[model samples]
Target: MLTETYQQPLLDSIRVIDHPEAVRRFFGLLKELIDIVNLPNGDARLVFSPSRREKGVISADINFFQALRIQRPPHRRTGRGEVEYHLTVKKSCQERLASIEELVFEPITEKSDYVAVIIGQSNAHLLTHITLRSCWEDCLLELVESNKRGPHSARHNSDVYRAAEDEALLSDLIRLADDPTLAERGQNGTTVEEPEADYETESASAQQPHNLILFGPPGTGKTFALQPYLQDGNASLITFHPSYSYEEFVEGIRPEVLGNQITYRIRKGIFHKACMSAIQLAGYGTLADCLNDTPENRHRRLRKAPAHYLLIDEVNRANVASVFGDLITLLEADKRLGAENELWLTLPYSQERFGVPMNLFVVGTMNTTDRSIALLDIALRRRFSFREMVPDPGVLPIIDGIDLPQLLRTINERIEYLLDRDHQIGHAYLTNVTNQADLCDTFRDRIIPLLQEYFFNDWSKIQLVLGDNPSWGKDPEQRLIWVRKKYTASATTRLFGEIPESVDEIVTYEINPHLHRSEYDQLPVETFIRIYQKPTL
Candidate 1:
């Protein structure tokens, strides 16, 4: 008995076979012809007419029209014949061919010879030049049921009973294909396999258009990581800051001197220029050029165009609300140049129609230490995907017995524990240290000052990170006290024991907040070395 697995291939075989015997095998069995319907993609459907002798007409959906040859081989006593034909079905469409499993053929004797008659109805027609012969009755009846409640019980339950499992799997595939979360994931960004500092070429998996923001602590190589994509000559680079605005980004009316008189004229900003360039590269046309646009020409131009990238450094530094203005909606994938929901607007100043090109992809870098991402615009945040680029101490090269990577990780771990991840120092801070002196200078100048800013002059937190105790007198036997003399009395003999008579009553107090910047500066370089000295393998 033919099951789904066997019947599917048989249908595929019949669809591609052009042999006359293969044709006669089925056609000879049919008592009448119905009609042939042509499909949109150059496939055809054959319909068999229902007769009084047959309960239902059989039909097969096929792609046999593209077959190059149609000839029947020698028929055997067993009634199976081999035939060859052209045309190939794409692997993507193989499941669609399984519709043939619905067909059933009944054996009928005519003039002492047996013929097979199709005994089922289907939305799908029959494949041309392919038929079920007398010897193939078992193969055909396998598709039919026996013992009809009425006389025609053979057709009962013969209609394809679609497996619930296959239907469920297909439903799941359709749901996944249309999932809104999947689109959000695409908007957010591709996964990073390496440290953000290591700028590899954009991979094939990363080709889709998305607004990606690489954000992390300072010196995590957010800016440096964009280099590889920019190498393609399709990139436009810009730096966003607190002062950057819509006038500097999209378009604005700028004052220009025409000879002696000053006049204002509409001018394109950096983003506007980039968008225009992207549109040109994307083969989007002006109303005039579209008049002559043909499918062949458009396809040719589309093949030649490359994706354009807009790299924004320090993106979070600029006020997104002021910089994006009305253009923010255009950043969505659906609103890009060639998308279904593509949008265009007339420039307020120039009155020119403009739209963002589909080819233009936006990549931005954000320094988390400089600004809190929580403060970023919700609208902008929704439009762009954010991937955090944390410092990878492993990428830091060791220098002067200082395992910089391990040390940076240790310091960041402490900072993350004490304060938060945003306050953690990046490995880039320590990467410049080549010798002990450079390391010391880095600690005194960059690292210490930054820690001071992070801790707000609270030396206790800094001391904790350095594995030092701010309460030095905890070891009472070995103590060093710093004092500030506020006033002097007239009668004192000695400084420690008794005051001199000439010294007017003096009062001294130990300064609790004496852990100054100078104290941090004077801290021995060995102190840092000792703090992180537990060797990391």
Candidate 2:
């Protein structure tokens, strides 16, 4: 015995060079190292440590490593007590717990920024040669215990949780990740089995842009219309606005207030955070995990899975020259992550130390009505694919899951009659209906008011659309009618003053540029004179 043999097995369990399995097995406990270490069919170094020794913890030392141990079931041995295998941890795991140390025999006492150590046995070693320093230890226990049957399988998280023993499950995943064969496939590690799969991966060498431009008049639902694309797991949304500062979006010194003691921490904004997360998850093969994976594990995404969207709502509102800055590079089909070209320049927000990874698509939306997109910078316009989303009546019917034929017809007619089919609103606003009550509230809150704004009148025309009232007209009488519909009958007198509702009505009118002599025949001479009196009358 190496004097520390009893304890050595425990420490060794966590010290796999890269193979989590070998370390687990060396420490004789039970027979679950294969599962906990997650070995499938490959070779990996299993680093080991018997226990923690806190002589002094160094910061930023290249030789540093973190430790995690897996214990086996107790049993009798042939000539000695009992012996089992101990799985070795990985360099990456240890690197995660920089500035922290693991101690054994005694629980870590003072909390002066100490790392979690699988106490039984463990030790740290420097690896400055490879520039791979700062090993961290994030236990996969919660992960594997929660997910035992593997992914894309129907194994309920509860099933894994209800089990009395789950340490083996995590151990299994870790071991499997070290497998060469599984890495060949997209299952164990971030690498793909076939080189051909890179086309679909987000971190792959080849990924093209999937940009889209949303354009239409205000309130036509361009913003809501792109929600699905914006949050589509694989997609990350980056807004372009005049006041949207680089400091706010990338990295900035945010004021940190500790009572009266205030200081600034290098706080990263949403875009930077999303980029870091994308870098972390760039290797995951599946879209779901790639989109919603945890912080550390998210880095598993292997393909670039062209970030689905980069919704730029009201893109025209932004000063195009300043907003995009150098981001235009990612928009190019030739550009990809890890490219050596200057086109894909790294931001100050992410030095190698900042930990932000590259690989995202930019989809900007511009409302032509806000400003002539024609005025947009020629440099930017050429780089992006300008796809317009003009108003279309065909896009407004959302009768999913319920019999709303009558309601649909009425609403459609109102939207079309007053707002015109080209200006009709998008139906995406109503996709959230869970039941009947929800349906009605949405109609009242969203549809009814929008229609009223178009007709520039009260309830009668709206009632005509809803089949609520009989008399429907394009005359002034209908304008007040629509307004009254918004309020109760008693409040009608209160709206638009005490005048008759008919007086407050808005008569429909349209300007005619070309008219023949007969068009004015019905008008009196005084009416003709009135029309012609624009000459400083």
- Quote the lDDT for 120 in model 1: 19
Span of 10 residues, lowest total lDDT, candidate 1 = 34-43
| Over 4 Å off, model 1 | 1-209, 283-304, 470-525, 533-537
Candidate 2, 11-112: lDDT as tens digits: 233332333543333222222332333311111122222223321110111112222333332333212222222222332344543444422221223431
What TM-score, over all chains together, does every model reach? 0.51, 0.42
- In model 2, the Cα lDDT at residue 144 comes to 22
Instruction: List where candidate 2 sits over 4 angstroms from the true fold.
Output: 1-210, 214-244, 257-261, 273-323, 326-359, 364-382, 386-423, 429-440, 452-537
Cα distance off (Å), candidate 2, residue 8: 22
Best by TM-score: 1
lDDT of each: 0.50, 0.39
How does residue 321 of candidate 1 score in lDDT? 79
